[model samples]
Target: MSREAAEYALRARADERDRISGDLLDLESHTTYQVLKGASLRGSTEQRWTATQESLTTLWQLNDAYRAVLRRAEQIRASRARPGAEQLAALTELLAGSSVILRAAAKPVERRSLIPQTDLRLTLDEAVTRMNAAFREVTSALNDIDAVWNRVLPRLDGADADLSKIHDLESELGETAGLTAEESELARLRTAAVEDPLGATVEPHLDRLTRLLASSRAELDLAITVKREFAARRENLVAALDLVRAAESEARLAHGAVVVKIALPPQAQPRSRVGALAGELDALDVSADPWVLRAKRLARLEDDARKAAEQARTTAKALYGLIGRRDELRGRLGACEAMAARKGLAEDPAVSESFARAHALLWNAPCDLTKAAAAVENYQRAIHGGK
Candidate 1:
């Protein structure tokens, strides 16, 4: 080993040993280690505790191993005060890596190294290579530990399962919903899971997927409700129309019960507004399976049928009372004319005028019962000498 190379190599090994010691001290005081040290580390966290404990044990072992290597390096330098060619050569070589020879405790005895597998002298170039690789194992393990705690473990706890469930349910919705958007979202979520498994991008995407999954579920429910409503709609409308017909029948019966006392000619009946409404309801778009439009049309048809039924009842009631009034008016006019004939006022022009006016009012198609009654009273008063 050259003088400069030897000095630099010794210094590097010593520095590495000091750095490892300091790092060990820092590791013992680390927040994660401290927190775990205080906790029970039971239940779901037992496995994580075991893994972290393994990493900590490896750190301790690395500390010991680095100390041993530093001691072996120091012994080589101290063996010769001057550090002659043999000493310097051995120092540089010993500083090579964990593959160097070491003496057992009883006496200085040669023992093959465990790490590198080969006995070849570790050159200056190999020294740098080994040093770079030295911290790789425990450092990588610590990183893995941190990642397991901070990322992979959290995801395993819920995120992974939630995302998978969302993807599955979204697929189900897409199956019947026939929406391209959900499939596209599932594809995007899968891509995010693959490409950014432990990245910030992934959690946000999973969150977005969750919200979208909820929205899709809501839409699915609406579609189901709309379908159920549509399936039952025809029957519902038919039932409503039946109620309308029953109500019409009741109105007709009511008219019948009252018409016997009225004693007036039967009024001409109008066309069935209820029948026209039923025809409109039957002509609705029940064939096209247009859910949204069909819902609107169905609402309109129901309203129309209801209104027609109500109007029919109202017209029947008015006709019943009109017939009663017309009959009553006819009887009153006859009584007034008879009184006038008996009192020698039957041929009077006043009697004819009052009778004609009353007849005109009561004989009209929708006879004005109010005016006919009033006219009949006027005739009576005139015949009774304004008494």
Candidate 2:
């Protein structure tokens, strides 16, 4: 190659350098381009950021290579003009080089190799290629940034909405009168969530918020069931109270109707214990404070009321049994006397004595049921062979 080709090649490199330098300067100056310079990125973002940084560094070096090769060309041209043995040796060395190696880190090495050649056409091509590659990589990084932003933006934006929904759920529980006295930290976190919705620390709580809402819903459902059951129990107590009164009234009526069958007034009546149970039931204040249905107190009260009703019914049965037995004894004693007359036992002294004793026991005041039963059996055996 002649001096003219070397100078022309140098001029061409210089022109291309200006164009690439201007483009790079514009890229560096742009606000959006510079935004992520010092900021740290995480996960896959970090890898992309590192790749982009490396590409930009390489492009900058390639752009600065134009100056380096031009300086070296000038030196080779100067040494070729003089044609000394040593100068020609240096010129030959420059002509032997085919590439312009641009190393940004080694300033001393670059200074020593200032005498570059016109043989760097390959270097120019490679630099342009690296610049295009770097530009494409930067565009890719920008796209990835947009994608990552899209991914997390909804979670960030909906943070407040989710928290508000949780509040609404809790309020619903409050409406049902089932809210527990225990407090949760969810309310306190709401303020922080509103302040920094995208904060890493608060972001994970979105899941917790969802779980809390679900848990509260379950608790509220259970509470509602308990509340309904308690209401049913209260109604049962009232019904039981009515049942008990009816049973008590039935006992008193039975006692009055069969007064002649049994001997006395008080002894034949249903026990006072059954009547006192009604008072105990009436004393239970269903309207009392802190009804505490969650603890099943209402169910306990209902059981007590039911038991009281059973007591009244049992007392009625006992009184009815006693009166019915007295009537049965009178009928049996009359039958025994008729049988004694028919069998010629009426004149028998033993038979007559048994019949008189049984008569006294069955017909008297506060009739001794145990003695009357034995006497009637004795009188029957003496009269008609225990018929």
Candidate 3:
């Protein structure tokens, strides 16, 4: 193909590439926005299923747009009649870069349903990396085209001037019959050269090039739109995730409060074992000298000691009840932990630690109720610490 034809073809390819890129980008942005909306809805106090559906729809649309762009890019790159060797190579590189981005964007959707916040973040990171790479490739291609035009413009202008000069010379010679046959042939040759320097084949290629450039520009615009939407959606998703975490924390604290309140005994009850023990020790009226105590007083002291001992048994029963309640709370906490784990929410270290503390509290013996109470207190502190 002629040089003009080749240049036009390259332009066309560039335009098409830009157009598809724009479309893909727009879709991506929309998808990301939807994702954020869904995440926010999930984190909200009210569970709105509509947001999830919107997210799914956005993702599907983004994927479809991405595929369409890829196919068109490939088609333009492979169109032998229009794309020259250098343009083809550039197009191929662009395709490769875009494929990487497409894969990155696709991965999050595939695993979003199954993964935790951390995994989702990883997938997003990959997608962003791929997107940046694709953008870089497109930027590079645009720069290369600009550079080529810079060099070619002056040369094309000079050629046009030369053609005009040759045409003027030919017109001047046509008025002279004294010119030789060789001169006449030379004039004819000059006319032909001026009229078709690159030949008729260049026109169609130039037209194709123009079309390709327009299409590429359109695609690029779409790509930009998609990217913006994606960014917004990502931000929304992050906010939603943070809110969900806060709610989980609040729930844990509420649960801990319930556990503490239930475990504590009412303060209005009669003398507990410890209280009775103190009373018994206080009532023992030992004289300044222990030998001076009366027998009646000593008998009274012995009876009080026996009564304190009996109170200790009642205290033990009350302690058992407290321990039982503590055990039940621990069991409930364990169940919550298991449920969270099954739902992929157990990645948080605080949740794991709380689960462990609850288990320890649950398994403690009733005889060591005092120690158990202290442990339960410590467990409460740990749970608070986690928050």
Candidate 4:
């Protein structure tokens, strides 16, 4: 109401109007809002989107009405360099009065109605409050829809990729049965995601499908690899069997030599499963058998054959180790005798007796290693006069 107050109000309102205009433009051009505007939606999303559109329409209408009022006030203030009391009164009425008409009453088309439909109007402040409420509604709608889209779209894409992998794996194995159910489930989930994303429960179903797809892929991959590598695996098995036989032969020869040369050597470990493993390998007919079945059999056969080979090799090395120990003792006994001779103790009765006893144990068939080692220790001590 005063001239100065009206002038100040006009300036403040101008700034508010500009700010509201900019915000409105930003909201309209927002990416999520634009996406919702053009999307074909269903379920709760469609319902919320419809309500949000009405709120957005009301928000723009309110902004336009608010701007019209501010423009009117600005026009009145600009009419005079220094407005009179009449101009100030008009500015006050436009700025603070119920000047924004939201809706006009419809006139009677056929007959006059007894009750009058009232016009919805608000003051400048009330218009802004209503616009803010509508803005919140619209923005909330955008957020909800954006959240659903963000959560479900990426999951759908991942499921689709898994489906593609299943298809590829199946193609490699030439096995395509039992996959239709998974494909149908994916299609159902995709439909729910695109249409009723607000209520779509996709993650649990997608997780189950993903696990199934992964298992199927693993099985198919194994079958494909087994089929392609069957010949190589068979060759590896044969090589392993040959190694087993060679190692077994070497162990037998060493066993015979030890039996003749040592008094009581430990018996060689018996050969294991060579015939049985070879029979199993021969029974695997890759041409007529399912690769899955053949793969299981081949894997068992390879394991058995390799273990047999390793055992035979270990046996041979042990038998050879016994012979090496005997030779080493003999060499040590000779060295002790040479040392006795160097000291002029070879003819010493006690020294000579220790040397002969140790020599007999080191040289005789079926040598008693425990006594031989004791005799050598006695000879070593006799050279030093039992020190």
Q: Pick the candidate with the highest lDDT.
A: 4
TM-score to true structure, per model: 0.32, 0.37, 0.18, 0.61
In model 4, where is the ten-residue run with the lowest total lDDT? 263-272
lDDT on C-alpha atoms for all candidate structures: 0.60, 0.62, 0.44, 0.81
The number of the candidate with the highest TM-score is 4
Q: Positional deviation of 84 in candidate 2, in angstroms? A: 83
lDDT of 1 by residue, 1-387 (tens): 776687787788678667756766776676655655665443334554566565555445445545665687678777866678887766765665444322222322365444444333333344334443543543553454455456534543354454455456545434343445655655665544433333324456556655665555555555445456765877877887887787677667766665554334556343365677678776774446444345456767878778867876786787576666678779888878888889998777887788788878767655656678898888888798867
- The TM-score obtained by model 4 is 0.61
RMSD of each: 19.2, 18.5, 40.6, 8.3
Question: How much is the lDDT of residue 99 in candidate 2?
Answer: 51
lDDT of 4 at 320: 72
Tell me the tens digit of each residue's lDDT in model 2 across 38-150.
55545455666777888878766766664565567567666555445564444344433435576534445646566543333435566578777887787667655645445
After TM-score superposition, the amount by which residue 192's alpha carbon in candidate 3 deviates from its true location, in angstroms, is 99
Summarize candidate 3's per-residue lDDT along 82-187 as a digit string, tens digits. 6676765555544433332322334456566554343122122233344445544434433443343444434444444444443444344322212244234334
Preferred candidate (lDDT higher): 1 or 3: 1
